[model samples]
Target: MDARRDVFQAIADPTRRAIIGMIAQKPVNVNTIAEQFDVSRQAISLHLKILAECGLLNIKQLGRERLCEAKLEKLNEVHEWVAQYHKLWTGRLHALKNFVEQEALQPRQANTDNKKKTKNIHKPKK
Candidate 1:
């Protein structure tokens, strides 16, 4: 079986995410990307490996230089996963809002009914 890394695991690192963003605009030389970070070039290369495994980054060799390009379509997995939860939570929140509004109105309705009852309470004839 092909041992591709999970996209979620790959993006969990802030550095990797930054690298993806940096390369997303345009393909960047591997050395240029390494220079932008405080970490060693070796460290950046490891991050690059994980991103490539996740199918989020593509590395190409042109002459003696390697260029990294962003392949963000893989992130649709993350987006679809998040959208499911978003829909679930949105429904829950809407239900909670309706319950709270009903609870709020019930108290006002009860007070109004009580006031009307008190006004109509007949006094015993003197």
Candidate 2:
């Protein structure tokens, strides 16, 4: 059985992420995609291959040239995963805000207590 590549694994490399961003704007030929980066065509090709394996891109051959097109729908998996944490963190933050606001609304009992203690301290050592 063939193992499927994870989309997150494919995008883990900065080069691969950049390639995805570039192709997402429009379908680009391999040569054009390679030219944008400082890396060799071979390295870029490897990145493209990984992205293709992850289902993040579709490569179509046209005569001698291969055009790479972005298949961004695969990213929905990543989005869904992140959205879950986003909700959790947002709820936690909201709860924290409410707690802080409630604390602020209460009277300055600690300050009053400190003042009472200070009054006793000023009265000479009985």
- Best-matching candidate per lDDT: 1
Candidate 1 weakest ten by summed lDDT: 1-10
| TM-scores for every predicted model | 0.87, 0.82
Give candidate 1's error at residue 95 in angstroms: 0.8
lDDT of each: 0.92, 0.90
Q: Candidate 1 overall Cα lDDT vs. reference?
A: 0.92
lDDT tens per residue, model 1, 60-79: 99999999989999899999
- What does the lDDT read for residue 118 in candidate 1? 84
Clashing pairs in 2: none
CA lDDT of 84 in candidate 2?
A: 100
Any runs in candidate 1 off by more than 4 Å, and if so which?
1-4, 120-126
Candidate 2 error regions (>4 Å): 1-4, 107-126
